[model samples]
Target: MIAAKNVSLQYPDGTVALKNINLSVKPGELVYITGPSGSGKTSLLKLLMAMEFPTTGTLEIMGRSYGKGQTGPIRQLRRMLGPVFQDFKLIKGRTALENIMLGMRFLDIPASEMKKNATEALARVGLKKKANTPVENLSWGECQRISIARVLARKPLLILADEPTGNLDRENALNILELLVGCKDEQTAVLITTHATHLIPANQNRIIRLKEGVMEEAEA
Candidate 1:
């Protein structure tokens, strides 16, 4: 669950990345954020991730509010989130399974359960064959799916994905989107930022469009 009320993000250089953004995301909801380059899509995700605090307004993620430079609370809040970064962020020389397991090392999960979750997540992404394969040897799309597997393995309440399909073909992109959408449940929500609007299927899911740092709901 996420709530942003008139949130605005401005850098120290006076660059305004987001303006008066209002958003609400609920559990089991799958929302797509579509916009062009420098349109504040990534900036909004950063705010939700607590990588940056709002210069104005308020943001509550999972019932926790973010403040300026609240490192302790920020760390605690982030632990409840599953983030899929644009860059694979997989450790080089590590196998796919290891990369997935590495994401949960700090959590309270037992070693065996961690391995089981990692293995299951990889299989769910259709990459069980690559379990032992070094991530550096995998293709771009594979790396992306591995990144997703890393997130799914964590089982966080909120999933924040930044351009998970940015570098794939149409088929792969659709598959990736489907994989992410399938992660939602009554206790989980999925929010994805992508520029490719054509790949989005017809559904009742929410779509927020950002243009020139302004946010608006896309027409149904």
Candidate 2:
């Protein structure tokens, strides 16, 4: 559902964060992008999310060219994507349910349905009891799960998570990974960038490695 061809990214200060990276992700597939810090893994995710445009080459999401034409198509394409950023960008004043409802605000979904979806999503991440709690009151792990629930509420076709387990303990990390992988069942594709090699799912064959802005197939 996502493809990048010869994509390159350069910062204003002449830093080359990515170099001729080419990658493809199919529907219902779960892939991992593993690399050390400054390896361009997050850069690549930013490009996919349209948060940053590639300096060179093309990026296509669900067959729509990302860097071309009107922003309507880009926004529409984003509607099908759910991103869990490294920082867990939750609104500080909003409750967990409110945060998740924000994902459906643009879709014209009914209020009742939105509530139901958000509750279900939070329950999926084992945070149903904290649905009405404000984000500021949550612990680090709880906040992270709430962030994932916010994305999951949208039922996005593609999930782009950057360092999804960076702050959690091993058990929580495993639970989050299982939740992500379990969502990849015929309609969704998941791409995660992480530094924890041992956390990588053993049954999955799709793994891509990045090193100093270079991309390559990772060995099993």
Candidate 3:
């Protein structure tokens, strides 16, 4: 569902973050991106999410080409992605259910269906009892699950998880990774970026290893 040909991203200071990143992700695929610090991992995700335009080359995501500075279209394009960002960007004052429903408020769906989806997502994430609890009152892992619930409720075409397992015990990290990869299906593509390479099951083949802004497929 994504194709990047000779894509490179350079910052304003002329520092090259990514160089000639050629990647193709198809539907029902679960891809993992592993690299050390400042290895252009996040840069690639930024390009896919349309947070930054490529300094050189072209990127097409879900059939939408991201031309330079197409803010309006990029904003609209994000609706097709269910992103589980690192910060767990949940609204603090709102309950888990509220935060989940609010993510889909702009999609023009009925409020009742939105609420139903939010509750179902929460239950799926093993947080049904905490649906009414405020986000600020939840634990770190709980908050992370709520963030995931927000994405699960939307059921987007693509799932982009940026460092979903940053700080946690090994069990927690594996649990989080399992949820992300399991979410993949015939229509949804799951692309995850993580430094905990050991958490990725050894059987996975769609792994892209990056170093010094260059990417290559690592042996499974």
Q: How many residue pairs clash per model?
A: 0, 0, 0
lDDT tens digits by residue: candidate 1, 87-199: 97899999999999999999888988999999999999999999999999999999999999998999999999999889899999999999999999998999999999999
Error (Å) of candidate 3 at residue 29 is 0.6
State each model's CA lDDT, in order: 0.91, 0.88, 0.88
Between the candidate structures 1 and 2, which one is better when assessed by lDDT? 1
Model 2: runs farther than 4 Å from truth? 68-70, 218-220
Candidate 1 regions off by >4 Å? Answer: 218-220
Against the correct fold, how does model 3 do in TM-score? 0.96
| Number of the candidate with higher TM-score, 2 or 3 | 3
Model 3 per-residue lDDT tens digits across residues 45-107? 988998888888888998868776787888788988998988999998899999999999998
Across 74-186, the per-residue lDDT of candidate 2 in tens digits comes to: 78878888898888999999999999998899976787899999999999999999988999999888888888998888989999999999988999899888887877868
At residue 34, give the lDDT of candidate 3. Answer: 94
Highest TM-score: give the candidate number: 1
The TM-scores of all predictions, comma-separated, are: 0.97, 0.95, 0.96
Residue 99, candidate 2: how far off, in angstroms?
Answer: 0.8
